[model samples]
Target: MEEERNTYLDELSGDGCRIGGYPIFVQYGPRENEELRTFDTLLLQLDCEYECDLMFGDGGIANFFINEEDLKKLDFTKVLYNWDCC
Candidate 1:
């Protein structure tokens, strides 16, 4: 059996990150009209005003989306990086 993806904010609410009441996604695919595809990661559809006011607008840049105020706000302990430093 396949394991479930607990990659949603609701699934991660226990960590204390503000969970947007609406559904967010960890979607993967190429951007519209581009050849080099952007990779997928946990992302929030953000309001253009940057209020954290819960009004979601166009999808924000992944880094900006995960940021609160000016500090970085993700717990990467569960994430694995297999890149070679060569």
Candidate 2:
């Protein structure tokens, strides 16, 4: 039974994907220049160890899975780079 369950989960995670929970989407205003500002807002609301897939273009969208352990080790400041100024 455990083996079957594991196999099912593996199948579900195919190509680095899983089908559970809803994604959190965030959009920044045109006037906002800092990327971290939006990131910080989203990061604070999420728990650690949460799985997140982010997409940014005209706007920013983040899909996070709650995981408390992962949240503790995340360094948002270092991760969100400022390429325009750099």
Candidate 3:
């Protein structure tokens, strides 16, 4: 059951650092907030880099999101920031 659940969640997310793609959430996702759900474009994602000896509070990943409209308009003042860890 645990493995099955993990697979299910994995299908819903992509774990990594990326730009202009869907976020790889380590914990809470955008669905938790109505406003966040509107931020459809992923601006940036920074995952823990083991080789670089960098971490965001124990394997946490950081994500930045921007509304599609805002991105098109080149507005970055409203980017939403979120991070989580195991």
Which pairs clash (backbone N, Cα, C closer than 3 Å) in model 2?
Answer: 48-67, 48-68, 48-71, 49-67, 49-70, 49-71
lDDT of 1 by residue, 1-86 (tens): 12344565436432222223332333432232253222223233332244564322343222122223222445433321111111
lDDT of 3 by residue, 1-86 (tens): 99988987766457656787777777779657986788788899998888888799988999898889999999998988888888
Supply candidate 3's per-residue lDDT for 76: 90
Report every candidate's CA lDDT.
0.29, 0.34, 0.82
lDDT of 2 by residue, 1-86 (tens): 99998988766432232233432334432214553234332222221222453324433332333233334665433333221100
lDDT of 3 at 24: 76
- Look at candidate 1 and give me any clashing residue pairs: none
**lDDT: worst 10-residue window of model 1:** 77-86
Off by over 4 Å in 3: 1-13
Measured with C-alpha atoms, the lDDT of residue 21 in candidate 3 is 70
